[model samples]
Target: MSTPSPSSSEDVRRTRILSSKLYFDVPPSKVPLIYSSAYNIAFLGMEKLHPFDSSKWGRICQFLVSAGILDKRCIVEPEEASREDLLVVHSEKYLDSLKSSMTVAKIVEVPPVAMLPNCIIQRKVLDPFRKQVGGSVLASKLAKERGWAINVGGGFHHCSAEKGSGFCAFADISLSIHFAFVRLNISRVMIIDLDAHQGNGHELDFAKDRRVYILDMFNSEVYPLDFNARRHIHQKVELLSGTTTDVYLKKLDEALEVAGRMFNPELIVYNAGTDVLDGDPLGCLRISPDGIIKRDEKVFTFARSKGVPILMLTSGGYMKSSARVIADSIINLSTKCLIEMQGEQNTS
Candidate 1:
């Protein structure tokens, strides 16, 4: 049998995807969904001092890839901050600090890993977020051109303008928004942040931008120092602790209605965090795994009804070892949602 050249194999399209952009770091450990069902997946990770090893993310990636959720060919790992791109939302100093912490590993004083071994390595594993900017930039562009598409692992919305927070090292969502406006001819954007924690980072970045409309569903008193009044000067809702899934869903229904009435977005960006699972260490609201599924279904359904594309990003969820399971569940729901939304659209 003759061997196919690597370049020839590279030209093969794996699936009939509505999109072609799922990113993983060079190290498979950096991709959480690689283990689920490796269809429509890509490896974009690197073997740096990534939190991947610490998080058993490599195992998670294997599971997703083995399960056939993440297709391996679309992988795209990268290095360094996007010089001009980082300037869109993050300050030069913060970008420098991010590089310093990962390069020399000497400037990192706050992280639990303290020195964060292999600064260069850390940057490699964390490549997904920056590429997320590119992925979502592509997703949004596709949404504009084809009506729907997706970019997994792009919603690190908790990080702020000045610094990183809640394990989020990059501001993928904000950067993507800027990319859309600057490169994709997009404005009048809407971000529906359902990460279970206030999207304080987004609030700080988009609070004054007239083109962005943010709807946040989070516990008021959570990590990362949120300013409730300013969090959504335009529109904010703080769900209390001990709130059940039913109530949360009802409130979400209402919130979705409000978003529809007020923003009527042409492009919808959803921060679908699975941390809302009752046992999530960082979340205040007690929602179940099934509840998380329902939440995503509703959000995707609503966005589809408006005849728009939803750029879904994975944001905050800190369940340690359960991270893989949590990640799988989120992607599972997300995959199922694409089916449901298409069905709903076809029927309608």
Candidate 2:
């Protein structure tokens, strides 16, 4: 079969995004923060083999609820992204490749998953990721409408249209942006990817697209070291493995100033990955819990001051303490008036 031209594939992608139900209207009672119970991945003991905290998404919400920062009833639930929705950014062949149990095991980096049947993997693992993808897409719409929105379970920045890696099986970030372009009428987006690992997936997807400006700050010594994708970052900030919070924040301040001057974006996509916490085995950075709070504050304050709608995705922090830190950072955002919680009238 002949490969489709870029323009033809773009047309098909636009059609899929336009027809997706992921961008449904959220009521006033429900917050723009998107999540669902289905976001958690729990299966036969296979999930235990991975270092990732599969239930961290649920735990984040649990902390928020227990702390009285948010009500369980006010949380917005997202529908799963169907196959048609996946086609917006993912290729048909790429989606088909996921049918193999070994393919999934490789993407998620879990050896035991390769032993399970594809049917079980699809139902238990991939389905949760699909729901998170839906949440990410819906978050863009909600952000455009409400000035800011948060998806408690997204920011799969290591997956691209044609490949998956670093425990990310779907291109949620790319899918979200495409949905915003077609459905929300957004033209310019600034991606502030602060994950400990390089956001190679989205960088590769938007490599030549001038509509998106990427500001990525990641540990220089990490997995999936893609030199090709590094070329796409507009403001690439590389940190050492054991960099302290002070140095990290200082660099971020400088980077944010440069980013603001370079791109007048209509939307800001903030990938707030808590993996940079001091004890995270994978992240290797020495940032404290307070540093994480201040980091989020700085990003939200930057976007708010620029008058750009910001969408935050909780990405790539699966440590045991990640949920509590994330919940605390979110609470800090609320207390500092950087973001309004659900059920409250949005004054911004």
- Highest TM-score: which candidate? 2
* Ten contiguous residues minimizing lDDT sum, candidate 1: 32-41
Residues 93-146 of candidate 2: C-alpha lDDT, one tens digit per residue: 999999999999999999889999999999999999999999999999999999
lDDT of 1 by residue, 1-348 (tens): 997685554233122111223322233222212111211112232222232223333444455557666544433232223555555567668877765544323221233244445454344434544555555545555455445544545566667667776556667677667656644556778988888777777778787788999888877677545665254635676777767899999999999998888886767878877667687766767887677777877887887788876766655565654356544654665487553222111232
Our model 2 lands, by Cα RMSD against the true structure, at: 2.0
The global C-alpha lDDT for each of the candidates, from Candidate 1 onward, is: 0.58, 0.92
lDDT score, candidate 2: 0.92
Candidate 1 Cα misplacement greater than 4 A, ranges: 1-81, 99-112, 116-129, 228-233, 320-348
Error of 1 at 111 (Å): 3.7
- TM-scores for the candidates: 0.71, 0.97
